[model samples]
Target: MEAPQQTEKKRIKVGIPRALHFYRYFPFWKKLLEELDAEIVISPLTNKKIVEVGVTHGFGELCIPVKIYYGQLLRLVKDHPDLDFIFVPRYVSEVKDSYFCPKFLSLPDVIKILPGIPKILNFEVNVKEFPISTAAVELGKQLGKGQNKALNAYKEAQKYFDEYHAFLREGASVNQALRLVQIIRPFTLPKKKSEGDIRFLLLGHGYNIFDTFINLDFQKKLKDQGVNHITIENLPESIFKTPVIVNPRGAKLQNYWRHEEEIMQAIRYFLTKGRDEIDGVIFLISFACGPDSLIAELIMRDMKVVGLPFLEIIMDEHSGEAGLLTRVESFVEMIRRKKKGLTVGRRNKLTIKSA
Candidate 1:
């Protein structure tokens, strides 16, 4: 008998935008898709053209990060026209009583308005209602995977995800960790902080903090200046998970927003236990972000009480590199002066009482 011709299995190609949650949960997504024999296509890094496209197309009231997300999705649609599906999970709530920002909840539906976009492979991720594995299994089923296969993929993805976070806790930048875990190709490694004289606690959502293009390469500039900084991601999970007392009235504020809660907890931890470790704080928040506005006021008040230097940089599409550089350079110099007991006089208008 003639040998039967072998049928080649068609690989599903899924596009993932390199924005927002990609900074946080990419490794898990990458692993899951790979296990299901899907070819993953990530949009290029943020650039001027991408920003312009996003701003032109995105809703007026949406924050810059969400706008950038729109840009990334459009890039995938325009550049990879043959993509089978675009993965845009609805991240409603990760923990009980705490939820993602409103934009995230509506992301999938909002992005569908863009013309010529590929089919969106979406699933709800509300840990309060069901485990992520349940969602992952359903996602796999959509890709024609068996329940056992999907569950196995989830287990593998979880393992890789934990390892990725472990790398972060060990002082790797998100890019570095992603590269180490083989999700992304190698790039120029970040400068080591071994000899830096000052340390700042950099606070922001991962999307804002890690996307160098949008943030105008803020972290790189700090590193180049030999100024060390730590982000909320670098700290151990236990520290940020601890509940925080946001005000002196002992009225424990339960922040319902997930990222804001982490930021608040991190600020509290630094204020109480890690006070000496950091010289100052640089909070990068998006313009017109409701949660950020509320949290920013509380952070400023808390930092003022502790007499720790704090600088809040508000970002939007119009944020210029020159202005950001000026502010960052001035903040670093001020911190250095404060640390050295050099007089930062009234002329400079730095109102934060020296620690």
Candidate 2:
């Protein structure tokens, strides 16, 4: 009894872990794979067993996110026997000005660490540098898709992704309503507040950015600035399509890379459409996060050219509030200066027009 032939099987199922940013990037992957005409299987929320299986699957000392992903993979393999190759999209950066954590850069290798993980893929999308066209074409070639078929699939996926995110941006207040969103991710986003408030984007991993103890007065200062900031904790429930079977309690956990992508989305949204609306972005990642090490490196370089002023700070268990405050103050001052210049520039243009 050999395995069934590829031709006789149903649609291939692509699995996405929800621990990280499944809430954020699900739209992009869902549309892309569907355009490829593939079915999707996202693992359910995180639970104790998922964590248990994760620890068992990983080496003696993998990080928490990797452990949780192991559990998700276990659930996927056990339940979805019809699943084919898993779709893992490699991403160096989401925008022209950003790259995620150094850890994110090693997602393909990391997934392989699971005890009996699925055949992880290598469809890397250097969003600005490579673009979807190139990645879709390559994936099509690998999966035996013709040029036209692959192109069509990629287009549909892009359309779906773009449309879905449009809805999210219109109403993606994920910072406070963490439990409200049905997706089993690390954080939950609260619902939106009243309008007429300055919107700020705090870009970082759930643990680092949300951990007030580590940052000390980060949120307080944002409130003081009269800015409402959002993070991974504030996504809607629509991102989860993959159900989990661990512990059966239905705790939502995201794949680490997924979280990275979501952060990129938030950053991109602010940088492009909301540049003027978003006063600034504060990027926070742990000191040794390889994925974010690179992300921080790239953002540090590009923020200069980015429309608004931004700040990148590394966090550890022992961070000083004074130093952090100084950095934040400097960044705020820069924003003030840019606003003044824009005002002056506009006035000069008007004067010339009148003359």
Candidate 3:
């Protein structure tokens, strides 16, 4: 479902695709634009129709997240054409521990393939020893906010951003961000009420977790089960600091392959840190992701012998709701039974029951 409108304001409405780096930078975006005195309108979470629309417009081989974004772009144009401008930030390379996989870098370029994308307020950032504030100034210039207004906005935005992240760094969850804003958050992290605090590791590209539909109410199920799972977005970029080493030649995400490598390293970290605490691993991958295919194979092989109870689900625009729910149910039951020390049974099979 779409989020309820906040207020009728004359401020510019910026459409943000709830994908890719949305989670990592939303607080920043929120702070920046609020400083710019513009209103933020986030695209609704990914869903079946949205996914299909994306596939219809996107390159055949792109991952599901990109397609979901395309669909969202179309919907925004059709539904809110009156908006001032839609944002499509241009980011290339690893900005600290946060890395934009190749596809993310290619997003603005791909917009030409789809019709009706509004004027994009871009803040393109590539490695060149330039300060992010300069880019923000350029963006301000484009928005017709006099250089001074833009400068002030950028300064205030940066300050708010530091404060926002400081709260999170202090162990505040997403809910805390909303609380600070005095807005009711749309989602919640699963509480620790679940017995024995059964834990599982969530593996997926950052885009998927933040998008609600593409993952098929996955969060609700976890919340319902009181399951505590750790998503990529849940971890701060600083976590990937000097402690977590990437590939020697460079685990640079030239493509999805490198993205998978980064995830693998994270898996190794989680496994080593909470081996006894984590009950199993649930990996979420787009239907056509190449890097994920290889990573899935590796995860299965590594977990199979050790009986780690692995579950992998594919998210395509066409993936059904019922099937997705069933798959999760099976995974949960499998873990529950194992916790009871029951007799061994065939498990680890993909349990998506499509309608």
Candidate 4:
């Protein structure tokens, strides 16, 4: 009689929603899932149908990014019906006194109860409170994986994440880091500048500014107008930790949201230390963001005092591409005129105060 043959281990299909944190932390998650020998299925990019499904399923008052997230989740379920788990990291506090948005903290809970959704494998990302390997260990246990194997996977994931950010700090856009690596060569700080080229600092969350469909190809629009831009992600981590951008009253503006703090700090830097380098600033904010509402107000006030040419584009499900293109064209023209010492009357001005 022949000896019994051993059964092959089945690969678990892990679905990752391609919105929100996906844009911020895709490399980390992708590496981790790959290390676990799981088949990863990332949700498709944001599109019209996905936005409609998200708007229909999500609450009307929720922020646009959260609504888009819901749509991505729905799409993941529909596209990968056989996925064994959906990875949703429960982001709490990454730094002292700073918190993730309340919606992000509650996302997994909301999706868990939704009908037809796959099993949610969530782990706490509050680095101050838990070990970084906590998520890997817990998820490994659920998958019947050994703790040592999970810990090793976490280490490798972290290594890749650090390298990814290093590329970003070296002046590569998120899209470049994600898609183009053959020509990528990391070098020392102070990446070469584009002398005499029009530059502007585009400020917003990754999901808002980088999502092509949601932001309506914002980067391309700027590039088409003979402009170059940098975002919060392009700057070094040390910039955010600086003690500048202080409130007028000598009290720090206590922004507890991590992303919000970075945005505000970047604004403060550009307004003070970086004022001469960039032509102007464009702020893209999503509607119904509690944190952004307060931060934008503060930024707008400061920008006016310095008389920086500022434009805040408020985006939502109802945002129109034609209108956005027109606004951008006008703003770029104003900056060009200002650069060329040509007068731009107040009538053609783009003001964040009224936005």
Candidate 5:
């Protein structure tokens, strides 16, 4: 008797856009999908072409990050025509009484308007309403997975997620941390720090601060100028537990926006415990970002009270490298001169008093 024919199992292909939350939660998604036996396709890094496409197709009022997300989605659709699904989760509230930006809440629906897009796996991630494990089980069901299998995958994924954060706490850049967790492979090992005379605390969202194309290679420029810097992602989670007093009436104000709370906590730490470590601060913000605009004002007021130098650079599609270079060079020069003047004044005072 002839043997019956056998068929190989087909793997489901899922595409993830390399924008926004990718910088924050990619490790978890990568591990989860792999555990479920799915093929993962990540969009390419941000480039000029992606920015142009995003700006053309995205809504006029949306921030640059959201616009770039559109561009990434289009690229995935165009490049991977055989993709089985695209993952675009709706992020509502991760904590009680705090929510993500409104843009994130509506991102999946917004991208559905794009032509020729594949099936989207739009999962709702509202920790206040349901745990992420529940969301994971539901997502797995859509991919034809059983509940017990999905829960097991989630537990494994959480291990990678925790390791990624631990790498960050050990002074790895976001890219480096991703590499450490085996999610990405092309990152350079971080260089040993030189004893640079000046240090700056770079405060911004992970999306804005780490996306090289959007920030115009801001971190590289700082290093090229022989200046050491730290970003918001480099700090540990323990610092955020202390509340920042934003009100002059001695009342503590809690931020309604979840991500903004990190920026606030970073400012509070630098101004108090880490004060002597940093010489100045440079804040990067996107144009028309509502939460950032309000937070920027508060940050400026706090910096002014302590008499620390602060530079706020507002970016958009129209932002130019020449202008950014000029501003950065000028800011660094000013800080250097101020430091020199203070040293000279102190020395002269000592000389006069001795004489």
Candidate 6:
């Protein structure tokens, strides 16, 4: 008698929200899940409707990014009904003396409690507590995978993640690296600078800086004005991962806030090494950010002492592009005049824009 042949199980489908940490580690997460033989569905880009839904349903005085995150999760439920699980990692600590925001640590718990959502697949990403390799193994096991398969998948995912970082080091933006891998387009750096061109440092969280809707396509506006910019993410990861150093005066201190550490280091690096190349610093901070409120004060003080020009732009859901554009124009004009050694008065004031 011939034995009946077994049918292969269907590939599990998983949803990944395209907000928050997605800006920083989308390649890693996407590759890891694909290696695990799961199909991936990313939430749509942020839009006005998404913002309305999030603002209405979200609880408390959540930050704008958190509201957007909730909107993305709600999108997964409405758009991907067949999804078996959604990956909402709990990012506790990535390095010593630095921790993720409380909103990040509690993200998975918040999503799990949301109605009409599928099961969430999350693992604690605390490097001190467990090896990252364990994340792959445990997640695979939950999805009916063998130990060997899980480990192999993770290894492949890590390879892709490393490659992504390499691209960033070579001057590609996060979006470019992500698209290049999927054959959307060839990798290319920004256009070469011409004589009298302006260069500046852009510092902020990935979610706020990269989201076009939230930021009002500020990057594009800068590029349109022939401004070339570099961000904290573009720097080598080693710079931020190093031990915190306090200056001799004790007034200049390293921030313990995880992401803030990177921002501070990037600022210090350019101010010390790339000062000749950069004309100013543009800080894009979200409203209601506790860490940023303190960090902003430190940054403003440091830049003042160094006599470098800086523009601080605060954004929220009620922000308008028209007024923000006016301030940006004024800042750029100031930078150009400064580069030419023109006597520009100290316009060193934080511009707050609210609808």
Rank ordering of all candidates by TM-score, starting from the highest: 1, 5, 6, 4, 3, 2
- The residue pairs found clashing in candidate 3 are 323-353
Q: How high is each candidate's TM-score?
A: 0.91, 0.52, 0.76, 0.88, 0.90, 0.89
Q: Candidate 6: what lDDT? A: 0.81
Between candidates 2 and 4, which one is better according to TM-score? 4
| Model 2 lDDT on a 0 to 1 scale | 0.61
Better of 1 and 6 by TM-score: 1
Q: How far off is residue 42 in model 3, in Å?
A: 2.9
Best-fitting candidate, measured by TM-score? 1
Q: How accurate is candidate 4 locally (lDDT)?
A: 0.82
Report every candidate's CA lDDT. 0.87, 0.61, 0.69, 0.82, 0.86, 0.81
Per-residue CA lDDT of model 4 for 1-355, tens digit only, reads 2333335556889888888988888888877877888878878779999999888888877888888888999899998899999888888887777788989999989876556898887767877877668868987787668899999989998998898888788788887776542233443344555543688889888899879999999998998888899888888787788534446577756777888888888887777877787888898989878888788888888888888888889999899999999999999988888777886575588756764
Worst ten in a row by lDDT for model 2: 239-248
Per-residue lDDT of model 6, residues 160-277, tens digit only: 8887787788878766676675453545676655633887788888998889899999888898888888787678776765654546477666566788878887777765766676
TM-score of model 2 vs. true structure = 0.52
Quality of model 3 by C-alpha lDDT: 0.69
User: lDDT per residue, candidate 2, 54-136, as tens digits?
Assistant: 66766654455545556777777777766677666677765544465554567677777555566775687687677768888
Per-residue CA lDDT of model 5 for 1-355, tens digit only, reads 2333335467899999989998888898898988888899988989999999999999899999999999998998899999999999888987777789999999888898998889988667899999988998998998899999889999999986877677677777776676565545533457876757789999887789889999999999998888888777778889978655567486657888988888888999887888888889999999999999899999999899887899999999999999999999999988988887756555666534554
CA lDDT, candidate 1, residue 42: 90
Which scores better on lDDT, 2 or 5? 5
- lDDT for residue 337 in candidate 3, whole number 0-100: 74
- Comparison by lDDT, 1 against 4, better one: 1
Clashes of each: 0, 40, 1, 0, 0, 0
